[model samples]
Target: MEFASRYLLRPSRICFPLLLLLAAAAAAAAAVAVPPVAQQEQDRIGRLPGQPHVDFAQYAGYVTVNASAGRALFYWLVEAPASAQPAPLVLWLNGGPGCSSVAYGASEELGPFRIHSDGMTLYLNPHAWNRVANVLFLDSPAGVGFSYTNTSSDLITSGDHRTAVDAYNFLVNWFERFPQYKQREFYIAGESYAGHYVPQLSQLVYEKNIGIQNPAINFKGFLVGNAVTDDYHDYVGTFEYWWTHGLISDSTYRILRIHCDNEVSEHPSGACMQALETADAEMGNIDPYSIYTLPCNDTGSLRRNLRGHYPWMSRAYDPCTERYSKMYYNHPEVQKALHANTTGIPYLWDTCSDTVGNNWGDAPKSMLPIYQELISAGLKIWVFSGDTDSVVPLTATRYSIDALKLKTVKNWYPWYDHGKVGGWSQIYGGLTLVTVTGAGHEVPLHRPRQALILFRHFLKNKPMPES
Candidate 1:
């Protein structure tokens, strides 16, 4: 007040022009406080084709993880409600070693939208996980969905290591693109081959953040559904699931146990392959991904279902489900709205890439080592399973968790949802395992309500509710 009075009293000495300039500069600084975020604005999605009205902000675009390799990963960020700002960020992936998260996770499972049967319109999934967190669905490894790589050979050797490294790079660059999300509580989640992707990426992110006091990634923990862990365990548990579920004969089971017991080779011997084929034949046309659900009768998926272990790449997409994703994503306008296909790649976008999965070069025999390291680091790790899924069934997950040998913190118990048994849960020293009774390969797709409940608990770092 005194300084202002002195200025007022000494009006003759005051510089009016300088004062005006100072005021103008202050106004400019105030305007800049929000940050223009030009690239983020450019990537903003106006609306997707036939997408229903939504209040939350949405963005979809490519972030270059490798310039020399011409590799870029695509991502779709569906933010939480305005009130949920400063909430945690969740990255969801779908494993095919080559699947598109946008096609599956976003369009069908945990994301905000689901495509209608006409393949032209969309409906909001009430159970969308984004209601609690900012959900990011990424098409990773530069070869799936809208992601691209000019270096042709990259896809052939896109193994676990490269996938993890590139994904870390993507997160680093993506944070730059949306700087506000940097340093937010972050998590990685997925199902299927993503069982591989989720952990590999989590380990990389955790390692990269070793020394930084406040790393931008700020990774919290991870959760996976029916993830592939140890190859031997997965194989053994899978065969058992088939037999116990009555999908295969006792003779076939014995042959499998005899010929497929070798843990060394993921590609079993000719004899083991024959036994697996025999088992697939006997299983009939049921969707092995979800034993009870009706299989997609589409000719392509139908033939592929009978292939050995290959059907793990296929989910329970009926005639209208994944079929709808194909039609909606392929529409040029849809791509335009999402800022996708900027390079005009020759191939049409697909839900999964056969070339990438077929040529995956370096899959470690086991992810148990990574699990042990992360667990000891005190990172929150949770694995959930759809009990009915034969591909990576509850038995497989249990065997893998057992191998971790962590002391049990809470014994197994039924978890309730809406006054009914939703599933079963057991909490270990550094991990939690839950099983959704009748869910399939993709729990969110089969039991969305239960999946959402599970997501809420994981984010809270709490165990599933006991009835």
Candidate 2:
């Protein structure tokens, strides 16, 4: 300043001590402001092959979750537009216990781009969730997608508990890598098997932040779509959905009820397997996940099956999208742009991993207990179901919510979007349940416009619009 130049900057006052203090102040400022932006630059996606031009910045890379085990998880973060900066951060997971959230959640459902059939090109998603909030997609559990561990044994042992811990670790490291998001309101979301992932992680975050007024992660609440909630309720509701929807015969429904109840879904008994097989056969070539959509006609072997009967849960209504992701992600050029597969993973990338899911070690039979704890803690919770997904149908979600026994704050009613019914919603004391009309397991993929409305309402913690 002019005054500082005349008084403070005099030759008499500006000595060795003054010079050193100025240098220290400059270094401290650089340490706080310069590095994080530079690190984000390193992860910036310059461009994707045949990708459409976009205004928002995108970054993708690995965050090491376990140093001792050389384990890491992959993430793709699509930021909100400049106008939405300081927006809430939402972490989206896709459940296979082993699926890549980038593949499903990012590319197919809510991310900005959809892979072209050429697998080498991309298109913008009109209803990407990033329109309203910063969206982060993660490929969790060291063995899924591009995420890997130097220790091969870790792959076979991927389970609910370990996956949650590693994801938490990823958040810790990721915040250090991009400190701007630290203390930002955060939420986790997923579908199908992630029904388990989202809530368990929510519990960990909620418990860890018990005493801190401003924890770095600042986890607020969660939203899940067509999620697997509890074994007994899921079993009862799934079988009932099949029979009432007329997808299975009367006799098969009886068989499922008799054999499935009380049986751990992760380890179904012989009688339960027989009943499920009968149901599968009876359902025919229709996609069980969507129930109404035609399946991808690639070779019969190309169908991505869910882990055992757990999700038969949502092989999803991907049609050829999964195939496109397989083709696109395996391309060396796309991988390079995304900064993925850096260590030369021996196998090609995939949308889902059967090995990881089939060998999953520690899936609990229920997530209702976690729901109880988080709900009591006043964490915002919302569960949405696509009415048509036989995999984790609305009926099953209803049964699970009924088991929670939360008092109803608002009776069920149709929620509207643009003058038409989008879905039905009900508000409960500590949670909310919404049913997206005509949607399948992948709600955003099936009814994107309605899904976007649901998401906007969710982020605002407002009830779905009755208009």
* Model 1 vs. true fold: TM: 0.87
Residue lDDT tens for model 1, 1-467:
01111000000111111222232223223322223367789889998889889989999877778767667788999999998777899999888767889988999998888888788998889999999999999998777777777666776778889999999999988898788987899999998888888999999999989999999998989999999888888878877898999999999999989988675255467777788778878988766777776666644565445434433323433434777888888887888899876533333667877567666778887889999999999999999999988777888889999998889999999999878899999999999999997788888888888999999999998889886
Scored by CA lDDT, what does every candidate get? 0.79, 0.79
Off by over 4 Å in 1: 1-36, 298-319, 343-346
TM-score of each: 0.87, 0.87
**In order, how many clashes per candidate?**
1, 0
lDDT of 1: 0.79
How many residue-pair clashes does candidate 1 contain? 1
Backbone clashes in model 1, listed as residue pairs: 95-194
